[model samples]
Target: MTTPNNGDTVTIDYTLKRGDGEVVGSTQEVGPQQVQLGAGQTFPQIEQALTGMEVGENKVIAIDCANAFGPRNDQLVIDIPRANLPPEPAPQPGMALQAQQPDGTPMTLYVVEVGEEQIKADGNHPLAGEDITFDLTLRDIKQAA
Candidate 1:
């Protein structure tokens, strides 16, 4: 059987678990994730580690946030005028909201603090700075057409 190589398309079933053992994501629970090997589509460590594994073989690997979603950046936190928010009561702290860019891409922001005139929000991923475990099994592999 031909093994999957760099640039090959791969369909994989995976479970992502946090350090506390909470399952943050599972393909078996929601189906599968499609990616291209060595294409920077997924974690570099995961892609590199699964290089030679055959179809149907399951492997477990751990990756830090730096190599996963990247470290939390303090610069990503910002404050916006309360008037800019939807017409509602003061924004609640610890709520996630989507802010659309001028280009139409939506960015996620986590509310951290609220003031009568402004609201503090952080754009860091919730799992940033944490190590996660990835259990992956190759469900399908195909050479690039």
Candidate 2:
């Protein structure tokens, strides 16, 4: 069996879980996910883990918070005036909002707290500060032609 190479397009079924074993996400429920190795399409650690994998191979890998989604950034949490938010939806805790970075790139923010005059939004990823485990099954690999 040929092992996956750096430029190969690999398909895998994966279940991602938190350190506490709570299911965070899974490809098993929605089918396999395809990734182009070395293309930065998936997590670097996951790609590294798949380096020597062959079709039908299964493995479990654990990644630290820093290597995965990264540690929570305190600087990303900000309080925005409620008047600045769109009036239609009425921002509430647990709501997701989009904002632009200083470089004009889009950033996602989660409403962490809603107050009478201000809304606290966190731009950190939902999974930030989490140690994740991935249960991976290599389903297919297409070598670069």
After superposing candidate 1 on the true structure, give the runs of residues whose Cα lies further than 4 Å from its correct spot: 88-96, 100-106, 112-118
Per-residue accuracy of model 1 over 1-145 as CA lDDT, tens digit each? 7678899988899999987789999987889888898788888877876677788989999887777777878988999998889976557988888998679989999999999899999988878877899988988888877
Pairs that collide, model 1: none
Candidate 1 C-alpha error for residue 35, in Å = 0.7
Compute the lDDT for candidate 1.
Answer: 0.85
Worst 10 residues of 2 by lDDT: 24-33
The Cα local distance difference test for each model comes to 0.85, 0.93
Q: Which candidate ranks first by TM-score, i.e. highest?
A: 2
Candidate 2 lDDT over 12-31, as tens digits, reads 99999998999979996788
Model 1, residue 75: distance off in Å is 4.4
Q: What is the clash tally of candidate 1?
A: 0
Candidate 2, superposed: residue stretches over 4 Å from native:
none
Q: Model 1: C-alpha RMSD to truth?
A: 3.3
